[model samples]
Target chain A: MKFEIIDYKDTRSGFGEGLLELGAENPKVVALIADLTGSLKMDAFAKKYPDRFFQVGIAEANMMGMAAGLTIGGYIPFTGTFANFSTARVYDQIRQSIAYSRKNVKICASHAGITLGEDGATHQTLEDIGLMKLLPRMTVINPCDFNQTKQATKAIAKHKGPVYLRFGRPKVPNFCPPDCEFTIGKAIQMTEGKDVTIFATGHLVYPALEAARILEKEGIQAEVINIHTIKPLDADAVINSVKKTSCVVTAEEHSIYGGLGDSIAQLLSRELPTPIEYIAVNDVFGQSGKPDKLMKHYGLDAPHIAEAAKKAIQRKA
Target chain B: MPEISELQAIASQVRRDIIRMVHGAQSGHPGGSLGCADLMTALYFEIMDHDAKTFDPDAINRDLFILSNGHISPALYSSLARNEYFPVSELATFRKIHSRLQGHPATKEKLPGIRIATGSLGQGLSVSIGIAQAKKLNKDEKIVFCLMGDGELEEGQVWEAAMYAGANNVDNLVALVDYNKKQIDGSIDDVLPLGDLRKKFEAFGWSVTEMNGNDMHEVVSHLKQVKSQTHKGQAQIILMHTEMGMGVDFMMGTHHWHGVPPNDEQAEAALAQLEETLGDY
Candidate 1:
């Protein structure tokens, strides 16, 4: 299958655009931010619907608690903040008030993982997916690009229970189809090949796609699947793709311990027990640098994914 | 308002329920539950404009109350059941499996009057402020009330919510601190002194009021006056002075009864002091 690159856009902008559209479409939607509207690209939503927006200042825990309460009055509240502040600073608040009670809240987290850049390890969150995954009823989504992120932002608003929507900071290739139907917990198969199953999420999917193209030049047929939603994983897709390939490679821009790779590993270990490889950050916090440089330094680029796919295929014997 | 005798009778019954429920369960917080018995009786019976018959999750045009410091579930469960949110006989099932009354107040079991869960400390004020904002947005004239413990003020998020409510002019909220001065370990003064909560909340932009929470007459009058003081450009906080355990003579002075259940003899002795006005479940 041939692929073309679309224009580059940040996934957070997709979330912002989705929020703006939600403001016009659903009057019950309300937004609360932790004093970082500009950073999260929420200026448009705040301006267009001033009455629905709440500037919650620097208190992320309070924002989460307030979001839970807003559900009592039949409002679907969307809370905005950095991923670190969104998850790490407020895990207990989210666990009790939102997840345990099953409140209709959308926790939109921008600047996830090492891609947050320049701001370094403190602002960058590598364990958010794992933290949210521990909650029983939380629906976790780490959409690949701008279009998918926007679709996910709108999708979670319609979902009744609590959600943790994760997106990135850097502008990546926005190649997802426009007007695509985004069903939560379903995987999007981008390319179909049989050599090694390549599963990716968030910022790493673009590089995984690019890696598939590079592998095809060398007669290696690598199938690439985008597992956007991490919690209610598409286990069937992972198992089916691995059934054909006999080996797998999982890629993510987060800590390999509890992120997408761990979920895929758990799925394969019990169901298929295939020899798998991973392309993710290895046991270290991120540092101040450009996002591209950080990706290359952290071994999360296309070449690294292509290498991992080859390693997993070689172990197939 | 209900007559003083009527309200006092309700409080006595709630106290009876608290001691009996805790004694029956063999494990519960009877001290704080008994401490806030009169407040719960007056608020649900005579003060707030809420309906016990037709239940609604939105709670539009109705007063909303949140138990922020939820360890005192016995008090809230007794009040909710006695006020007809559910069958009063269900109060006998406190802390048992499959019962709506949890060890901490929870909304997951579909308890009629509960809107949010609050087992962990210091989350209720933030949630109440959010509900107040919604009421203002929905053009509802009702007020939001939150009951917290003086020990819960040690949590930083309580102050965070306090600041947000004051700075944003969330004047439709009424927060009450159960100043029982006792925590699980020891006295709050020895554990971590709050250092003048009235002045502190006032500095955070609340219209502060102090009340004797155990006094039936004072509890009714203070809450009635404060309901009118809300929605006037300042939030309200009632620094209610209450004992850790108020009604029973043996449990009134110390924090030992904060979570200890009465054995058979202790139960009989404690039950002898408080008169039962309403029949036990």
Candidate 2:
């Protein structure tokens, strides 16, 4: 693996742009926003398709229920809000109207993870992925970068069931292959190595890629896999990659308690009991600070992932 | 207005269906079903103007009715079937395995009259608002009607929806609260006091109305008067007062029959008191 200093872009911008495109391409694609329409980068969609856009005015629960009903009359509804307001604030609404009834809805959340910055613990929702993944029919996607997030937004609309697409505010590097195809449950192997397998999602995927570059300098072979779809996990890809590497490091922007790491651990524990280590927020809420400082405090930075990978490799050996 | 004798006959048949269906399946919320028998009968027999025989599930030109308090599915199912939405014989399959007459109202099993799945409280009003908004957007003249439980209003989401409906002036919607006073746990006042429902609706910018939900004549007259209240830049809220279990002698006064199945003897006794006005399934 080789290190490359890449240009960065915010994934939220990707989601907003994609939403506008969906609105243009399909008249049925209607959007609903809470007060964070500008923050979620949904202003473009809201401006261009004003009739199709609904300003829900800080009422996420009403937005969710209305989205469910909008689907009844054949509208492909996309609900935009902060990750916290989209999930935790309206878990029952999403559970009963959307997931339980299996409505065709896209719940696009922005400002996920510690990268949300300044707004603090209340806004930084690391537990959203865990809460959404527990839903039976929800397709949870925490894409790695701008391109991947945009691809996911389009992909989820074509998908018939409920989807939870999470993206962050920070301007991370746009490093994925520009024209790469995106299949919802398929894991993309960003870099391949032999010593350890690193499975990461959301903002952590970029960090894992960084750690892979750092490890290569030390002659430590690391295989980086982006577990984009958290719910219908790319199990075969994970297991196959883990078998080659013989050790695993699972990373995510969510809590270590019940997010991607937990799902991967559950999978490896049952079939292939590999030495697995995690890089995620521990049982604690984040506070107002720079995104980098918050990520470090939560133990979810590239250095933390690099250390976790080394630990897993040593444990496996 | 529908004749009192005819309305009484429909309600009697609906009550008979409620008792038999609950007994046949050994499950369901008979208390609320019996409680809303007159309301359902009034709506189907006289209030909602629709051609029941031509059942278009999403007919844009026809009026839409939603049972937000979906636990009362037996009453709704009986009303729809008797109006010929489906074969009335399907009543025998209530709550049984592979039956379209699910414990709650559902559209999943291709149930003709059910527009959406409901059982989880506080969601139906929001859905009804969405439907009403759609009707307005489409310039459809038909009204959207939804029935909700007084207890179901305790859900915070319901209030959120109420706020949105009032703010947006969703005038095409008519929301009826079954103010039966009793809930599954106990009386709503003991569980959680709902202070002045009509005032709350009025504060929320709704045209509030109250009616004796058990009185067929009042139900019919109020429904007609409320239609004039529609498209007036405000939503309509009807606080309907009724007993929890209205038809059966033993079940009427208490919340005991809320979700309890009637035993064979209890079923027979209840049925004997109510005549087979439209014949049993």
Give the number of the best model, judged by DockQ. 1
Tell me the tens digit of each residue's lDDT in model 2 across A1-317: 54353569999998988888898888878888888888889999888988888887878888998998777666788999989988999998898888877788899999998899999998989899999989988999999888888888888889998999999999988877656578999998888899999999988888898898889889998999999999899999999998899999999888888899999999999999999998988888989999888888888878888999899988975
Model 2 agreement with the true structure over B140-192: per-residue lDDT tens digits: 78888989999999988888889888888999889999999999899899999
What tier of docking accuracy does candidate 2 attain? medium
The candidate maximizing TM-score is 1
lDDT of 1 at B227: 91
Q: List DockQ for all candidates.
A: 0.83, 0.53
- The digit string of per-residue lDDT tens for model 1 on B235-268 reads 8899999998888999988999999999999989
Model 1 Cα lDDT, one tens digit per residue, A140-246: 99999999999998999889999999998989999888687799999989999999999999999989999998999999999999999998999999999999999
TM-score to native of every candidate shown = 0.98, 0.93
The alpha-carbon root-mean-square deviation between model 2 and the true structure, to one decimal in Å, is 2.5
- Looking at model 1, residue A225 earns an lDDT score of 96
lDDT of 2 at A52: 85
Worst 10 residues of 2 chain A by lDDT: A1-10
lDDT of 2 at B185: 92
